[model samples]
Target: MNRTDLGPQRIVCLTEETTEWLYLLGQQHRIVGISGYTVRPPQARHEKPKVSAFLSAKIDKILALQPDHVFGFSDLQADIAAALVRAGVAVTVFNQRSVDDIVAVLWQVAALVGCTQAAQRWIEAVHAQHAAMRQAVQQRVQRGARRPRVYFEEWDDPPITAIRWVSELIDIAGGEDIFPERACQPLAKDRVLADPLEVVRRAPDIIVGSWCGKKFRPERVAARPGWQDIPAVRQGHLFEVKSADILQPGPAALTDGVAQLHRIVLAWMDGQVAAVLGQGGVAQAGGCHA
Candidate 1:
């Protein structure tokens, strides 16, 4: 189908990533609705009517829009997808679980919107950046340097580790995630450290918190009992990465989030080396507290 004649003319995106991706690919004209939580591109939240939220939607309002296609993600959005399907509205739900899955979904969405060439170009550019970053990380790893043990907290109520894509980026950035094996789990509770004290046990060299949609409070994290004993806290290695930058299942995660992870890890690793060599006091790694 030609871009002008693509099947979907009026689309509702139930997630931020897809909405942002569509806009980036110059297909925003087709979008009629978006999630209320979308803030990546900013203008989307202002221009498009919000018909849905993360795991809920106003079915009547969405149906009223008469969208030709509705885009959603994961089992979290399964109910919304079912409701639209029952209403005889076409919907495509992407259940991407990893970084690679996210990239594939980008291509698939572009194809669905008849913007395959645009998607390819965008993908190539991201891939080039990823390649360069990966090489730089590998070089740092090969220089007889110890990879920092990173603890990525996705939530604090029960303490959750990083998701698959975040974990992958940590590895690519030359750091080993504390809960590397649990990276693929979807729910935060599943990745939670049952003991809460396990974080102390792991002795992570760096701590990065995203805290989903809320602003991360380093002081709160540092005040946890026994947490002060952890190397990351004692050495001031705690950092906050915003959810939009690292947790989004889209190009922003791969580009902005991964790059942030790389920079943080690199700085941490460099600090450790510098301290061991008696060059100066421990290096302080910076983070976006937003």
Candidate 2:
């Protein structure tokens, strides 16, 4: 088949997920422009002209690229999409909030470019990986491993909690999200902890911070007033998951992000068991004395 005969021969990806997906689909040739924030398939930055950031774009530069189609994410990009649409450029803005939505968007993008079968195979592989992780968690629970309470910080200043997909991943990774109710809110503002002390009250056993592009500072978190008493703080159970890994709301989140979460949970469980044994208690296979 002639390459141009497929839909959207020349495309612009305004987000990392679509760009990463196209690359994984062996359709990178179609991408003429990409987001500056793209780091997943790092070579995309060197190979494609960066025409957009997360919330802003160089409209004239994007137009110069003459992309037949532009892919973006979320209502946050509405203005950019509108500008491009007014200029006679086709745009698709996907708002995928959960793991299922991410998978669906992956299929939609693939099918649009005549790669449905390829996408199907990739989706199957993703499902298998997810299943393996779930099985591991189930076995751990069956062995009487206590699931730790996890508090995932998306932003530090206002202390926003995990999104829906992240909370779901934590559950699948053998940890309970402390602010699961906040995860249900799609908007970051809606998930904001009006009082940061609420996190102290929640007393998460593990704290994972991915402060959206900024490095996570454990000391700063530990120093928060009254936070010292939290189990995670007292036990030094704080960790960092990079924004690019867990905050992307795409394949990266499903794969690398979830894997990291699982590792963190498993390590914590092992530590709990060791703590019990060190205290002269018999280490029970199905339960931790600590």
Query: Against the true structure, whose TM-score is highest?
Result: 2
Q: How well does each candidate superpose onto the true structure, as a TM-score?
A: 0.90, 0.91
The sequence of per-residue lDDT tens digits that candidate 2 reaches over residues 40-152 is: 78898899998887879999999999989999888889999999999999999999888888899998888888888888888898889878877887777798878899999
Tens digit of lDDT per residue, candidate 1, span 97-165? Answer: 687898999999999889888898889988888888777767776887678899999788888888888
| Residue 227, candidate 2: alpha-carbon lDDT | 97
lDDT of each: 0.80, 0.82
Prediction 2 TM-score vs. true? 0.91
For candidate 1, what is the lDDT? 0.80
In candidate 1, which residue ranges exceed 4 Å CA deviation? 1-4, 272-290
Number of the top-ranking candidate, with lDDT as the measure: 2
Of candidate 2, the 10-residue stretch with the lowest lDDT total is 281-290
